[model samples]
Target: MIERRLKALANGPELRAHLLDPHTEAHLEAYAGNIEYGLGTVKMPVGVAGPLRVRGLFAGGDYPLPLATTEAALVASYHRGALAINDAGGCTSVLIDEAVSRAPGFAFPSVRDSGEFVAWVLGQLETMKAVTGQTTRHGELKGMKVTIEGNHVYLILQFHTGDASGQNMVTLAAEAICQFILENSPVTPDYHFVEANLSGDKKASAQSFTSVRGRKVTTEVVLSRQIVEQRLQTTPERMTDYWRFSAMGGVLSGTMGVHGHYANGLAALYIATGQDAACVAESAVGTTRLELTPDGGLYATLTLPNLMLGTVGGGTGLPSQQACLNMMGLAGTGKVRALAEVAGGLILAGELSIIAALSAGHFARAHRKLGRERGQEDTDTSTGQGDQP
Candidate 1:
């Protein structure tokens, strides 16, 4: 029916043939509620890294890291780091906190009116909760914060979205809450909007570093001196030296968080496991620290304050994505937190490998070897020699 309608439009037949092939048309019904205009699917190459062992509060096991990306050496880098962590009995990961926010803006004529509105809204928390409950069974209105700027008020409603990324869930709940507010409040604002762009949704912001967005997780691993020297091809002292210098560079350059390539591993994993890939903007914002242990080993840690993802909703139910989740034994109910832990572990591995490569002066060499075509010449003159330490 949808295809027939498209076929009636100009150049529709050509577009449909390219996008909606016979195979896609056969399973078109399965894509309902997931896509609009429903063309087809884009296939991305997926690579598996690990049997990565993770010891966490919610996740405990060796799981394969399925990464979908076209960039070569990404999977290999993460794979090497995962093996190093496993040699040291894996990383320790913890899901520290979880919450999604929806910040609605209200514009009043005067500061007095805004203050009055905020006070009244605070008093109506119970009523707001009731309205939110009607919107989603899996979402709960955890709390609200009122930020007043001049005559404007931003109501940041925080929610605990069970087993899902909860962007849509929180938005629906917030919309319902706003409707109830508009109807019941004695003080009406001059105007209002459903979202004020203050929640840091799909954007990187300093706010997410201080507060939770989706899921806050911390993962840490201690690699012995021998292991670092053997697996990473660098000594613990050299890695720490490079880390300290790199951290200083980040601060001088005013980067949001000091880390090496959190997006590389995370974006790949998110794509493979049916997560909201765009959330990587905020989800990838965090800190990675490497220091020398008292015993002369290396202590590495990664803390992601906005690790927004789910194991049951959005793309997770898709056939390919579900298969990837199943490969890791993390799909469906009671596994979201565990899935988050695995993400933390995966990210930590990438950080370890990338930092090691840079410190050992093998970054460009590895990239040229794995990322370049066989006959591609290294003609760039930015760095004098192809091999430099």
Candidate 2:
């Protein structure tokens, strides 16, 4: 059995027991699109952070966030940050921009043929938009960007997917559009492919970061100086100083974003919400900034450039995932922006916690206390450039 194979490879008896049983096939069927072979599931512990209040364009009020992760102190740290934000009236989140993107490629026998196709493509832009629009009820083809290299052309299609993530929607829409091109265009391409690798889907690339891939959410919070000192155990001035140094480190290290531990919260949040967990690769790339207020308080901002998420599709129909989504009032259409807002809120909470820990010089001590078991030595208690870079 696969369980036996896993046990042999992992060299452990624990896998033996866990793999022996899993959510029944009937239960798994809903979540798994294609169950080529049945293998058991790995379970991770889920933790709750917040009753962290949110003031967002879509999601408003207080709600506890469900973060599914096994990292020892992750939940605790975010929880502490949420407490601090809540103590300061809550985070103000906004889904600043929203779009779903896909890139399709075409190849021709020669440069002249490709140029003819490009001309034909430009001519058919209106018809192309009309044809793809027929594919989905909620989705609309927003725009198209063209790029060419030698005898090939790639079309980057952008869509407003409503409440669904729209990967499938875009794929189906692309197929319809491609078929139209193959049949209706005057110049026939020698070969064609659905994706040209330029779309930057499910990966961290400069294009996806700068342009919209999923949802671009930006959240801001103002913390009172008293709250900063009492809850975070640091002053606003010191935290801002650390942020400036960390920003430089991020730039020197060639990081896409200067945020602290964005992936930590995003991955956990994605899993809990039944979001396409792989989307976190592009979704978590963004910038974080802290400005010391004139009154000695702090103003913190988290801007996520590509937060690809959907509330009505993909793994969301699964019962357990549905339940988790329900907890945050996000289980149907027209709620994705709300879900995105909450995600931005959580990101804010997470980044705040990490910087505060660094400023107080308790960065290593708290990890030592919460991250270990039994009497294991707390060896990794260093607050240095190593932690940031």
Candidate 3:
């Protein structure tokens, strides 16, 4: 199979040998339904950053975080920022909101029918919630959003999912809710579907940005001027100025986030801990702020509105992924909120370091140094072809 793939790519013997190397002892069955023409597991470089501290509603104390990424200087930059945060007595993290939602739309023959359906749905809210409750013990119907068009109506069901990312959970709950609506609602629709495209599940849309999709979490830190100058090698004032400029740039560009490198930390963490890494689509959108304090300190905050994470289910049960989750004490129930806080803390560290490097004029220099090092690591001929017994 690998030989065929290599031939398809028009590659050489050496490349074929390299491709088969990582598969030698891997359990291909583990990925039974996950891949096609599977040869092996692709490896990612996971770096541990910080014995960083967090004071939060759920997460507290000091711990080392595992960040898996291929980007050069990502781990180092976040580490530097974490150290600075540690020096300033650590940071505080909090989970502010939680919900997982799906919108199912119904199109009727006329606007009056849509209105009747909407009115009926509103009246059956409690019954709808009860029907959804039968789907899962961990998921509870939280709320519903209603949208009306010319002859279409959308009912967005929201659920509070415990210890899971909730895409599947909410889908199940929505199914049960839909069944109830179908059986109970008086205004029958001309047509209906499970997803109305109003939920904004995975894509960039105004509804997701305006409301909660998964969990809305906020993490903040206060960097003392001494820590900033000593650890980040930049003045608090300069960092603040740069942050202001960056915020303006985001505004001018009309971007969803007003932050620096939230993806860097979140992506690495998500991959390491077996999260649905694609959820970073909505999870990565939020606000970051740099507030200047009178004592020359910097108050930094990163708020993630749709951080989809879980300590169980999905890829979390995979051995290596579970190990990574366990490393952060995130391998059991009641850890989802704490994990969100940790994610927020890491984002703060990453942003602080990148902002510092930008202010100190070392961004390019560090990349040049670390990136060349990465290139050399990739070239180390330590790989060998696999043999099936």
Candidate 4:
């Protein structure tokens, strides 16, 4: 029974020795600690364990681009940000709701020769029976962007990339477009590094000089009532004090790493999703802020600089990852963005929970209990009294 629980609780070998009955009980104890510390269920009311509002906010925050991570107190620090403000008063919280990316780029380059390129592209479209003339009119191509640099043009083809991440579909489209351009256009066309898998790793060779054509993919959020009263646990004044404390702790420290609230949670989620755990270093940095609205509500927002996540590719397409994706209702179109959003929401919630604990002066106590358990086990071993009572 303990082994089964341990398998459910942890994925790999680092959890090897610790995968015992006591540790599993300890994990449950931590949840109990939450109750003891006055952290209520997320479903509860204001000053509860959940967020006050279920909305989102994204002002003074940039796009959640693909980026790196830090080893410092990142997730914890983000939690600190939440705590600092929550202790002062109630505040609004914008949880990341969702994110997705589309690929295949454009059928042709946009440039000085754009007229010729478009004509050529149209010719190719005419040749392909798969080209749905009506589909183009729909919003499927709404986020499409194009750019040119000399002979090289980049296409950032984006559709609503539902749940499956659409990476392969985009790549196929891009490859077809590149073929058409090379055959029809007079200009020598090149492509970016392609490894069948667009890992976006720096090491791949180029088929052409690929230029970034699309906008930095992103999703926005706004927080109002649901975020207040619940997530932060305090009113406006307390929120201000929280930010003051955060300012002293290098809120903008790139080297310092991810905000504290996201660290453990993201690590666990990423592991569950089969994402490269090391990449959490990049996907974690974000812009965190707290503001007061005219309506007297405290608002908090966090925009991750990079969220290198995929829903259908890599591990996401693998059996376990696919199962997890399915469990989240993110198995198909538009679901990847939904996954990102849920991740954001959970991360924000974690921030609130961590902050609430710290402000109420229980974080240290929780850690102390964990340490005491370890210490007692050590004493038992030394005295040859290792048997469990």
Candidate 5:
């Protein structure tokens, strides 16, 4: 039936042969709730970086990072960073906060109506908790923030979702809360939507830096002057100088967060670990700071305010994603917080290596040597000289 519909759309036999072969079609039933009109899977190249060492509240010891990407030089750069960090006795990572939110918008007939609705909603916190409890076994209504914009009121409902990314969990809970408000509230909304776009779902926003969307994590490492020079092929002072310049560039460019390439490492890890890869939009927003320590070492930190991920739900149950999670010993229950810490560490490693490469004038050279296709000359003049390290 699926093939017939594709054929009607003028898809050629050869295309179907590659996309819907017997091996691929056999797994269609398993993807029931995850997809509709399932075509086939695209095989992405996966690589492992680390034995990156980390010490955190939930995560401890060294763990291999499973990254799925086709981008060249990415895994190698992160691997180099991980090695440097390990030599420095690893990084300290911490999961600072965790929460998932859904902002439901209510349109009122007048500003007075919206004002009354906000007051009523504030008084119904306990009632809203009860409504959310009926929706999910693992989700809990933590708190909510009411934003009034003229006659429209946005209720940002927050939830504590255990061991899951909680996007769907919070959405369901928010819907129940909205339903309760519609039934019991004194002021009737002209109309209401479950999501008001104020929640910063799967997008980069200023709110990501100020509030926790899913998980907020901070990871830091201190590298001695000798270690920075030997392992990163750059001096601490040079790296710090380049970091200051980069920070200024970020500010000038109006970047939400100041970091080199958080998305590169995050997107790969998310894909490999069965996370909502789209969440990288906000998950990658963070600050990376590099400074010279009093003892002549380099003090570096990466603080990510939005790290939406899970260990037991969504894509985590899928075959390949589960394998990746298991490789890090982060599969199943009691591992989501640890996973967030590891994610922070992973981003820190990438940031360190990239900054070192740029500071040492090896950025373009490394790319030309490892990032380009075989037999391809370095023709991209945009990045300046591709000097050898």
Candidate 6:
């Protein structure tokens, strides 16, 4: 891998005139190997594509999972996606964990903007725990969050859902919470309640937003519609079938391909970081959407809602893994999303390279002539000459 660094001695257009040369690059060598803070748990693969290793003080448990090559491609593709955006236009992406979900055996009640109502709900939660003979440690507790948008209030319930995304748990929690608020709170009974699960979807959703960028950054892919139509031997009208199989819940013409990019990047990062790779199965199945722009370019957006990738938790505090994380310059609490975003960007770049290769007809020929096979004919000729002599 080649690493390059640039520093501006002074501001303005003439700054390049005063730029340092390779001699200056030599003086900065000592600062090169210093590991970035908080990224001590990412083990890079040896070859161009190989197993990533992560070392850390991890609890003895089931945290290992085998990832497929296709999955790896998706991760690589998202990385490329990031590069594309960086080149085309400076864009920003904000990640929010708005999943108001829970575990199956837990329940939480929502409440309105009244101190008295909150007191009542707490009492009810305690009573419910007693009636069900359940404990929070045993995964029978409900989690809830409430946000204010102007005079309107929205409540979100989060459950420590086991295995599954815990959509049911969140739904139940939100409903119960809403019921509690309407009945006990001092606010009016006419407040609106929406049951839509918005966070984990592939397509963007609107709400009382906690975070957002100035411009929404979306990943778009353009595959010749004619080629797609030829691949499946179907008309454009049947593109919906392609969308269903490619990404569930996608509309006509196809589903979103962006999530495929996320899946690819995270798997590689997971393998490198010694994280629970299996979590990626659920992580990748999330929101994938495909649509078309007015100019006929296909757009894909994949938003993974439950990507529990961490930089400081689990195995991130180790040796070689730390070095790899240092190479990427990623660390800290809120930086996981930033890392994810970067990984997403890189995967997109990789995918674009892959797609372009296949489309350009060089994919097969590039690998066909490598290794001992390239010298097979020469070896055979040498053997024949020896026998004749």
Best by TM-score: 5
- Report the C-alpha lDDT of model 3 over 277-314, residue by residue, as the tens digit: 89887777888899889898989988888888898888
Candidates ranked by lDDT: 5, 1, 2, 3, 4, 6
Ranking by TM-score: 5, 1, 3, 2, 4, 6
Q: What TM-score does each of the candidates earn?
A: 0.92, 0.89, 0.89, 0.48, 0.93, 0.41
Model 1 worst lDDT window (10 residues): 380-389
User: 252-303, model 2: which lDDT tens digit per residue?
Assistant: 9988878888899999988887888998888878899999888989999988
RMSD of each: 4.6, 4.7, 6.3, 13.6, 3.8, 18.8
Tens digit of per-residue lDDT, candidate 4, span 193-297: 212223332121121122211112222233343343444334554554565576556546523322445556566566556455655544555544556667666
lDDT of each: 0.87, 0.82, 0.80, 0.41, 0.88, 0.37
Where model 1 places Cα greater than 4 Å from the true spot, the runs are 1-23, 374-389
- For model 4, the superposed segments whose C-alpha errors exceed 4 Å read 1-143, 149-152, 190-239, 244-263, 274-285, 292-298, 304-338, 354-389
- In every candidate, how many clashes are there? 0, 0, 0, 58, 0, 37
Worst 10 residues of 6 by lDDT: 380-389
Best by lDDT: 5
Task: For candidate 1, give the lDDT.
Answer: 0.87
Clashes of 4: 58
Segments of candidate 3 deviating more than 4 angstroms: 1-29, 33-38, 373-389
Look at candidate 2 and give me any clashing residue pairs: none
Candidate 3 minimal-lDDT segment of 10 residues:
380-389
How close to the true structure is residue 289 of candidate 5, measured as C-alpha lDDT?
96
